[model samples]
Target: MSFCSWFKEEEYRNHFEPGLYVCVECEYELFSSQAKYEHHTPWPAFTKTVHKDSVSKVPEEGRPGALKVSCGKCGNGLGHEFLKDGPDGKMSRF
Candidate 1:
């Protein structure tokens, strides 16, 4: 059995799943499912943010070059953003 809850996970490889992804605590729009991509990792990955100025960042204490990102509206920590292979073969964003 599959544990994926995404509506169209059956065909959403490196493509948005056809809905919205938001912060669980704040319900603020984070990224469009269409911006989603298969990162081949446990965490859901996005190509970019759907809303502008909706995120905040702080330097991670232990990680030398990592920046932790959070929801600007509710101050909820989202995750850390670092360079990775983007869908366009370029570095991706938070």
Candidate 2:
């Protein structure tokens, strides 16, 4: 079995499956599966935000380069991404 198969089990589908899922913590949509997510040394692994309009980096008025990915519905921290390959084999910024 491959490393990703271990997470393909039904039990982890809600949390690790590859697809569009909603973040219960932030209510933002988690587009990629755990399989596509990579440990980029910032957070618990990272993946693209799925929807470009779903996230954005705006001027914080005081801080520069201060960008935050928030929930589309609630505007909470859904995490950020970098230019990387996703599990789908597409070049994306996750």
- Candidates in order have lDDT scores of 0.64, 0.44
lDDT of 2 by residue, 1-94 (tens): 0112223333332345556656567667655564344432323333455576555543444545334455566665544333333334443453
Q: Write the per-residue lDDT of candidate 1 for residues 17-67, one digit (tens) a residue.
A: 489867779899988877777675445667777788667777778877566
- Where does model 2 exceed 4 Å of error? 1-17, 25-28, 45-47, 60-63, 79-94
Instruction: State how far residue 43 of model 1 sits from its true place (Å).
Output: 0.3
TM-score: model 2 vs. ground truth: 0.43
Can you tell me which runs of candidate 1 are displaced by over 4 Å?
1-16, 88-90
In Å, residue 76's CA in model 2 sits off its true spot by 1.8
Worst 10 residues of 2 by lDDT: 1-10
Q: For candidate 1, report its TM-score.
A: 0.70
For candidate 1, the lDDT comes to: 0.64
List clashing residue pairs in candidate 1.
Answer: 16-33, 16-34
